[model samples]
Target: MKKLVLWMVMAPVTGLCLSFMYSPSAVNHPSSKTGKLIISFRNSVDALPLELNKTYINSLQEPFKVTRLKYYISHIELDNTSAVITPDANYFLVNEEAPVSKTITVPFPAGSYHRITFLLGVDSLRNVSGAQSGALDPLNGMFWTWNSGYIMAKLEGRSPASSLPLQQFEFHIGGFQGRDNVLKKISLAFPGGKPFVLKAGKTLTIDINANIQKWFQGPRSISIATHPSCTTPGSLAKQIADNYAEMFSIVSVTD
Candidate 1:
């Protein structure tokens, strides 16, 4: 059997100290009064939850089954009416097949935040930095090579629309330089523009839905019959990035 290795780096490992930053105009609260923020990623098709190996129809009306799906999320930020709060930079790999990898929890200062923003891919600095341990470890199979950098996001599955042997479609999106850069910054406002307060010593849960159907449409329409493979970064990769950049939306917030 072929080994299935999903791409993208993991989040901060256990025991890493997470620091919170407050804007200059914001009040500095005691570190002891911090709360916890739990961000959850829910992957789905147009109207159904995504399941591995289950056939689903895309915007192009193509039937496909995803065997693996993985992506990186980084540089998370939270914004309130008064100021913007940022957590220490961390790269997280959200894998569809791994439930534990889909949720991220970090300590955050208590505040009423109405907006959240984050990068859809690894930063340029981390791309060029020499091999590191933990999530960024090259052994994870997300890194392409020393020159090509990491694979920001990856999707692999079978589709009857594909022309390749075995009717397989693969998209490994990555690039950190010049015109090929696929890094995208995504910002989403809380539903109804209402802020959710996180009380000290308490936890606030934010559910985010990622619609896979958005990958096939948006700024561009991609058909597996025409373009089934995107192993390297270029214009097509950028288009796909733009499409998936709109895939994330806030679903619900609980405090």
Candidate 2:
């Protein structure tokens, strides 16, 4: 009994000594290396890049034009074993028509990243916290005045499949509370099909596939004619958001 007790008491001390001897103060003395990450968004199908102002056939065989496609992305995190890279400017609003808004550059700690994760919309806290600026600003025309919340995504255009006035269809999706919350967390592993190693001062550009056809696929096929718009919180909004959850895919990654 005494021998066993003595071993147990000494085990912790031995571990502590070993840890101190083998482990350097790595956290305090982090590697002074950082890199720039470039992210791009595009709408494509069948691996073919999409052309705006052009009508395309969905899985439902309905013709539609994507005049505008904008969405919010926030809280980007690059997964790492030793450290995570999260830039100070994490919120972004991506607009398809605006060439400049389609991509963003962020600074990150130099390291090997295994996966990339990001949020599709503002969190519950930000929604309830009142007005904000930058990507989450109300002047962006993505806010819902009646309910008071930022619109996570917007899909507006004309469609021959619609019976609505002028054959117009507008989808403004946003809800950051309760069961109808539209916030989506997406995780991408080696978005370039391999591990990304960031050099000390290099930049890596990645093409993101923002497939719009996915909006018509999911538990059910979405009809542009009947369901012209989904601007409120309910089953339709949830369903539409679910369809858009898989909108992002990695097209190319260049270091």
Which candidate wins on TM-score? 1
Against the correct fold, how does model 2 do in TM-score?
Answer: 0.82
Off by over 4 Å in 2: 1-32, 80-88, 191-193
Candidate 2 per-residue C-alpha lDDT over 162-252 given as tens digits, one digit per residue, 9 for 90 to 100:
8888888888998888888989998877653568777878877777888888887766678997698888977888888898998788777
Task: List TM-scores for all candidates, in order.
Answer: 0.83, 0.82
lDDT score for candidate 1 against the true structure: 0.82
Native-referenced Cα lDDT, model 2: 0.79
Error of 2 at 7 (Å): 63
Q: Give the distance in Å from residue 146's predicted Cα in candidate 2 to where it truly belongs.
A: 1.0
Deviation (Å) of 228 in candidate 2: 0.9
